[model samples]
Target: MRLFIAEKPSLGRAIAEVLPKPLKKGEGFVTAANGDTVSWCIGHLLELQAPEAYNPAFKKWSHEHLPIIPEKWLLTPKRNTSKQLGVLRSLVKQASSLVHAGDPDREGQLLVDELINFLGVKGDKKAAVQRCLINDLNPAAVSQAVANLRRNQDFIPLSTSALARSRADWLYGINLTRAYTLQGQQVGYKGVLSVGRVQTPVLGLVVRRDLAIAAFVSHPFYEVWAQLATATGERFKAKWQPSAACQPYLDEQGRNLSRALADNVARRISGQTGTVSRLQREHKKQSAALPYSLSTLQIDASKAFGLSAQQTLDICQELYEKYQLITYPRSDCRFLPTEHHSQAATVVAAIEHNLGQLNGQAIATLPLNLQQKSRAWNDTKVSAHHAIIPTLKRHSGLSKAQGQVYGLVSRNYLIQFMAPYEFASTEVEVSIAAGSFIAKAIEPKVEGWKQLFPKRSAKAGDPAEDADQLLPNLTKGQLLSSLQADLLEKATSAPKPYSDATLLAAMTGIGAHVSDPAVRKILKDTDGLGTEATRAGIIELLFKRGFLLRQGKSIVATDTGRIFITALPDVATTPDMTAQWEAQLTAIAEGRGQYQALMDPLTEQLQAMTLASRSVVPTQLKGLGTAKVFGKKKRARKKTSA
Candidate 1:
């Protein structure tokens, strides 16, 4: 029997239905009419053995066994997934050949590859092992992909990379987490200190933000604005442009810091008529946005539905797995495959059909241009999986949350088929008494791709391009009769706290925070701290560990979180280490790097860091749970006594 393994049961069933052959149903697998077997896994059947798995003594937490590095790694069947693992193991023994029909990403490769290793089946030969890679779950795509299968041996490097990442995480997380936790417990702290390769650095980011915001001191400043009306009773506003000589009242960024200077300028410009020194108009174009990646979709969903990162991913997973309305929801790739663009028409038709079924009035008025190929489609730019888009399969009875997430993916994909939004913008320089002020306006003539989104009216003098630009008919050298000026007082604020949306952005683009240039460049090429598929889970883990608290939409590091980060060394808490590891993992996946090259050094580092924890007295820790550990925290008096 030729066996095929899918990442999930729904996927296995979908492939079986596409072949048009009656499949024999079994306990945990299915058999096709041709006698070929198709089995499924509920994601990973096995997980890395925990610290205690290596030895019995390690089970108890103590500083004596600090930095416990596994001499030989092992895998244990997950409690709930043992039945499926057994079923697949039995089938693999009977089958002479195997086909890996798992998802295309590295995680999927690891899922099936590790299972193969555990089953003790030889899948080294071309005929003995094969791979099925397909992005869309539709019948046609699946059939075509299966028809041209490659040897599964070719994906060994991908699996190797995944293994390296998993072990490295275990090495760091298990040892270092124990180190800090034991140190904290010794000092009489009662809470568990949780840490990880990615989550620790991410927590550091929130703590840093809180520190910055807390340290910020407000300083008042002034900005001058002129309210003016044209000759035809049309009104507009501009600002007094500051020069380099305004240094005394300006900061490092050249932002004005003087109220008196702004007031003096306002006085000079009030009621002073100015001439339009220069007038320029140019047509601007806004190309269609690329389709949604997991992060981008998370951001949009968070903004549109007020959903957290984890909530968005859960809903999207439901849409992809349960409803089959969208392709592979775990994808981080934003670019669509050029060769696959031929299926664009089918996806559009499916979306239109689904919308028609549900009376989707949101996009009923917008027409989808099937032939318009935007920059989103590219042959080389596509990754393991393409953007999350509506598949060629239409699903009914989707939940409200699923429908909303589906709609976002659908509209983002649909917009790429439309023309660029075009607008003619006008900028005029007004010569006032104090200085030259500028007036700008944008008039959108072509609502091309903008038709998909609700039109936003721009406030007058607002710099945003889409805002309403109600401009009067004026030319160069035009005279303005009446003018009024006033100085507005404002203060510079510290960086805003990290919201779920901003926190994800930070994780994806954390190279901005790392000081080392080489590490920063590597982080730029390699995806940030965690893979797109796992970032949501990482955030959820932080919440479960009580390291992060949700304050409305913002993600605030808890008191325990701040302490944990401050307790760890910079080598562990900074993004530089994880980013460098991610880069090496990418190399390992491509067959250019060795696993031991990375792992050996990491083991030594974790052991060294653990040994260093001997001197750590948790109660004396400057940052971690200080108030609680010291018993010095107090509540403010209800009434003030002088």
Candidate 2:
């Protein structure tokens, strides 16, 4: 009998549904008519054994056991899912052939592969195992995936990369946490001084940002605007562009620091005749945004719906697993496989059905050219899983949050089949009394896909675009009258505190924060901080550990958090190490680097850090009030009728 072991029950059921008819359901598996069996793991049936499992003496958290690097890694069944592991073990022994069905990512690859190894499916049996990568749970998608199963051995490198990352996190976190917790205990702090590869750097981001904001000194900057009018009496305002001679009076950011310089320029330009020095018009087209990667979705959800990262992830998971409305919730890639382009019409139709009449009407009315291929449809950009997009399956009665997330996914997918937003951009530069001023205007040519999202605010570019009015058509050297000069004073504002949206964005695009160009490129190439599946959990972990707190819409570092970051070394609190590690992990995943190459130096680094941690005093931890405990709030019971 051929046994199919899926990553989870929902996926197992998805696989079983596509098999032969007359399915017989058992306690933990389903059997098809052709004597094929399908069983599944509950997420991860096993996890890496803890340090104490290696040796009893290591159970006590002490400096003496500082760098407890496991010479031989071991796995133990997670207690909650131990019974399922047992069932799989029995099934594995009875099966003549095995199929490994896991999510097509590093962690998912390791999840089922570990189970196969732990259950003693060895030698030829393990070598003969096949891998089925299922990203979408729809019957059609699952059937397609099952028909394309490849040898499981091909993914050993991917599994090895995940294993290295897991063990590295364990070695780094366990050793540092123990060493630091001991250091904190020396200073009479009662809380656990947790340190993690990803969490600490994340906390460091917030703490550093908070510190920068606190230290910022606000100063006034002056600007000179020329209010000019054409011969036809159409008027527009243009900002004064400081000449090279004005450098002495300007700040480093090119802001006019001297009010005298600003006032002089304003007075000189007012009511003066100025020649239109330059006029340029260009046609521009903005394509629809690519589909949602989990990070981008979380970022948008945080901004639009006030949902936290974890909340967005949970909602997407439901949309993927429960409703079967989205392809996958944990994708890093934002581009779809080109082959998926053929399903555009069906997916759009499904989206319309799920949207219902009231909302569906708008989607139906969209000029969706089903054949228009956007930059988002590229086979090469597609990774282990394609972008999170609407499936061909439809559903209704979703919760408000789920509906919002589904709408976002569906709308993004729909836009891919629509035309680009076309517009005319005109820029004017005028010279008045030796000072130059400029104005720009954007006029819509075609709403195109932008019509789907009415008046959505642009995230970047000029902040004053909304205030800009249309400029009159003029030729070069055309004379115009300067109506008036407006001298405005503005204060330089401090950096905004991290919000859910900005923080998630920071985690994903952490390369922008790095100073080293080479390292920055590496971080960008490797993605950042954590994978799409784990970033939300890492951020949530910081909050639970009292390293972060929410104030209004802003996320700030707690006193405990600030103190902890201050007490740690720069290497422990920065994203540089993460970039370096990711480079090695990616190499390992692609079979370019060996496990020992990454781990050897890592083990050596841990020893040095643990040794340094012994003499370190956690003085900053003192005087901080008790750490806030975060847990599920108990629901209030309805008052009993007397």
Query: lDDT of each prediction vs. the true structure?
Result: 0.80, 0.86
Native-to-model Cα distance after best TM-score fit, residue 414 in candidate 2, in Å: 0.6
Q: Give per-model CA RMSD.
A: 6.6, 4.8
lDDT of 1 at 509: 92
**Model 2 C-alpha lDDT per residue in residues 404-503, reported as the tens digit of each score:** 8888888888888888889999999999998899988888999877766747556564343344478888899999999778888888999999999999
Instruction: Compute the lDDT for candidate 1.
Output: 0.80
Give a tens-digit lDDT track for model 1, residues 449-491: 7777765654555342224547788889888854668677777
Which parts of model 2 are misplaced by more than 4 Å? 357-361, 456-466, 623-642
Each model's backbone clash number: 3, 0
lDDT of 2: 0.86
User: How far out, in Å, is residue 206 in model 1?
Assistant: 1.3
